[model samples]
Target: MSKTLTFRHVSYLWDEAKALELAGNEVDLFIYRSNLLGADLRLTNYAGGNTSVKIMETDPLTGQPVPVMWVKGSGGDIGTLTKAGCANLYVDRLHALKSRYRGLEFEDEMVELFNHCLFDPKCATPSIDTPLHGLLPYKHIDHLHPDALIAIAASKDGEAIMKEIWGNQMAWIPWQRPGFDLGLKLEQAVQENPNLRGIILGGHGLFTWGETSYESYINTLEVIEQASEYLEQRYGKKSPVFGGARLENTDEQTRKNRAADLMPTLRGLASSYRRMIGHYTDDARVLEYINSNDLDRLAPKGTSCPDHFLRTKIRPLVLDEPEKLAQKSADELKAYLTGKFEAYRADYAAYYERCKHDNSPAMRDPNPVVILWPTVGMFTFAKDKQTARVAAEFYTNAINVMKGAEAVSEYVGLPEQEAFDIEYWLLEEAKLQRMPKPKSLSGKIAYVTGGTGGIGKAICEALLQEGACIVAVDRNLLDETQTDLRKRYGKDNALSAAIDVTDVATINDSLRQATLQFGGVDIIVNCAGLSISKPLAETTQKDWDILQDVLVKGQFLVSQEAVVILRKQGLGGDIVNIASKNGLVAGPNNVAYGTAKAAQLHMSRLLAAELGPEKIRVNTVNPDAVLRGSKIWEGEWAAGRAKAYGISIEELPAHYAKRTLLNEEILAEDIAKAVRVFVDGSLSKSTGNVLNVDGGVAMAFVR
Candidate 1:
């Protein structure tokens, strides 16, 4: 349950500045929210959470201090507080604090942090968490509450639970108050094992740290989610809504046009989750819920969680058109905003009051989360796509929780002051700062069947140029080929394996080895295929099976293995099936090859639809016949084709080239590019597309 809820990308961010801000704020928020979520949900909240940043303050040569740690501040709520909720305390002070005690005794180290402040006035008090954050040597530190911790905390045999869940792999501590003792205990645990990833705070939360903020954040989320999944499987009831979310982008003209502009912005926002982005406006279920009169009489269920308030606002903008419901909803939203923010109506007055405390600009956009137009239900707004998604997810979860919570207590929220504090926190803003850009496929790994073949080699080169690491699998070890590739790039960038794609064991072994070697595979391009030039009468079952084994079965086997890894990674993937133009058009003599190729195309479509929900993209590329390296030259199949058509092979190239509307011979490179397109952003809305890279062959049959 926790695993499903936790977004795998909670840690990594594309924007370095934002990544820094996100890491810091996330760690702080996880720590703050853990208590509210309890050990179970807090563990779900973050497997581990830590924060740190590299900022210049003064030159070291000039004997000046540098800004070291932006640690979590005390008395901040995870559900609300933003970046400013964290404190920027000196690293040296934290280092000293860790040295002073076996465990973190944060209160005892207050004087050290206060004295080490690089810029603050001497009178200002340091954040209560400064010593805690400082105790670790990591650039980022996070304390998470994994679900297993919570379950153990809730259980009568917590010690048994601890041993069962962690065994000897993790350190455990009894629950304690947030600030001093917990920090000290954690510091002591860290000292005991310098290589420790983190310590489980018994009934409290989990602690994790990383060399970088992103790593810390990701580690935290992963640990928590895993524990949550384990606990939920053991003890949790299935949610009333248990199926996977089928979020399709709406076909509204506004949405379609907006998506065009929105995709790039979102891609730039977060490199991880923003990959091949798609979003739904209002899901069918949500629409139904809004239209149902059943909810109209019932009070509006407030937000699911506090973070959602920034996106969806307190409640969904309800729309049930008996008469003029859309207009009524819009008006209601306006009224609600007017009623909610007292100062929104008198912005000028509020502006004047703020000017007295040293002038800064007023809020940029005063409009809150939800907007409902007449006849139109609701629209949630955020600065970017992630926020919008977060809003929608929260709103959905909140609605369910509200249904049950209302039966017991009114849906009260945190104090407005706390909410406001989170809303405008500068540290939170900083946490959103961007990072030095990573290469296009720095973290991406790919598997290429027939990787030693010419076309396969070209595709591998193309993917490699884009920064992807390749796993090249052929029937025999291509060490020389791999050595050349490695020499061109680096040793860690490519792997070569020997495996028969026809055999299930061989295919599985190849996939397992590739995954174990590279951590995981992302793109699987099935270039390992076979062709037989036998007449229909001469085509034997053995021939058909051979073709299928290398083409159809081979592709399926590779795709299956890749899917499992992709699902585990919680990231979508790309699969490309290289089918020949013979598959699309009629083939006279090559019965088995054509049939297998045609089957491969259909298989691609089926897989695309089946894997769409997993975010795994699938597509096929149909290429015209071509010699291995040809300049208007024909292959044996081209000659066979010419003979079948009563034409000379010499005229075949011109005849076939002219047959296509493009009036050109299709090159292997052209087909490879199309394969790249299936995995690239060439067609944003394309999937299950049998892209014809054939030079106008079968012009009437365009797909």
Candidate 2:
């Protein structure tokens, strides 16, 4: 654990910038330097820090050089600092407005006022720490809650520790929830010590400033390095240890396979709480932390720093005595996880009740973001996978911080009252709740068969945009297609599986896996299908068998498994089968394809009736002439269709578009739209019905 702090930047563009005299002074340098500063999870996980540079810009209206500080925008991560991520604000106005609300602490009103003080109204909302940057006299100001600094900053003896570490170099500003009052407090602290290099907010984070971005960044790192050295010298490896650094002693691959085996149950268990859950267990850091013998004691001892309260809860939920879990049945294991989560939640509620009388915000959800199961490793939950990954990163960093602190002294967590003040502070809570309203299917899980292909990706993407996580099920989709999806939705939100859609065992395992990882399935999209377009006389036995297995048997097996999970969850879900137009109407050379789809369409109506009592709705989406991105039309299939129409392959789309009643070309996206409508339960009461997405093809109507 004797690691060095890395200050590597892949590229700084210093040479080109130097030619223009804006090398280190320009706003873009803040973006570049901020990205580097934010990239280190050890320093700032995800969007945990902010960076800025004070520059004078001529106002378009006033035609005068006004003082402006470019601050990290709210919801913008320093790790991905584009120009748009920085908000320019008039520093004078921000400081001047502070005196008007000197006595009043209005959370929402202060945020509103910050928005109005924007130098450019077109810029994003300014950071809540805007005044901290604006009021400081330094030309460059950067703030981050580095765990090492926070370990001492958040300690019971923090002031003494800091006073000893830096003497009079850094000022100590006692615990203030980040807001207008805190900003003014920082202003007062600076006024008292004009020569101070930086200020450590009590139980909060670090603020370092210098004349240039490089100067500020260097100072930030050096201060942190100094603290790390002191902590290490005082109580690192030399100290007597509690169950020193023991691991599961299994190979990495074996650990991951085992974690995967029980992940669905984990997801299902966490989902039973207040929010949808996503996870990251592939991390070696998380694995090392969880596998350690001291996890149960250290993991639940509250966050090493206050900011982690926003991502991880006050502490993690640890399932002790995991050996017993191995003996339990799948249902038993699920129940065990559920029980542990419930107990954690109940305790959280009690904690909130105990603290809210001291002016905390309304009790947020009691769900713990970090779940530590000894056998299965660590899983971090969020509303979606992207945020879950960030939580995972933060929790992983917490592992290092807490252990590092433990090695120094028994890692003293912030008192419950102080943790509460930081957790429910209106400024932080407002940012958390300021997100856009949830969609109808928001935080719901949807499993889409054939998720890698055109229609499947489209369907999953649409659901994702509306706030749903999709487990795209396909054999090949598990590779590149899944990677692309993870890139779009998030590695946590988009999952992929290679499975036989027709095999009951394979189908069941896929559903269970999704269940454990996403709290059981809420919407199932049956989009996996194939068809042979050979003439009846030319078609062989293999073609018929292939069509029947995927189009009919595959639908039955996957749907059957999904229903079992939904029934157990008691959530009343939706199932939308992607049946073809050929199911309703016969076309030439479509004997195998049509008959199999006919069975699928009939099976939907039958399943709908049987599952109606449980409130699980079943419906069919029949799309026609979807020439673009249809997996069914690959290889000889497209040529065969063109031959059937007596036209060149290139002319087929035009020919098919004209075949529709509306004379418009149908696409996979159109089919995905129909599936979404059904999944959203827009036609909630209507099931066992067929909705066509073929640009108004009259022939495909359910006559």
Top candidate, metric TM-score? 2
Which ranges in model 2 have alpha carbons more than 4 Å from their true place?
1-25, 59-64, 93-118, 159-167, 184-195, 229-258, 272-275, 291-296, 329-335, 357-362, 428-433, 475-520, 560-570, 638-664, 695-700
User: How much lDDT does each candidate structure score?
Assistant: 0.54, 0.76
How many backbone clashes are present in model 1? 34
**TM-score against truth, every candidate:** 0.40, 0.86
lDDT of 1 by residue, 423-530 (tens): 444433333333345455555667898887767777777777766778888875489769988899766577788878767777766666554444456788888865
Give stretches of model 1 more than 4 Å off.
1-436, 629-656
Best by lDDT: 2
Candidate 2 lDDT over 546-573, as tens digits, reads 9899989899988887877676555678
Clashing residue pairs in candidate 2 are: 264-516, 264-517, 265-516, 267-516, 268-519, 385-493
RMSD of 2: 4.2
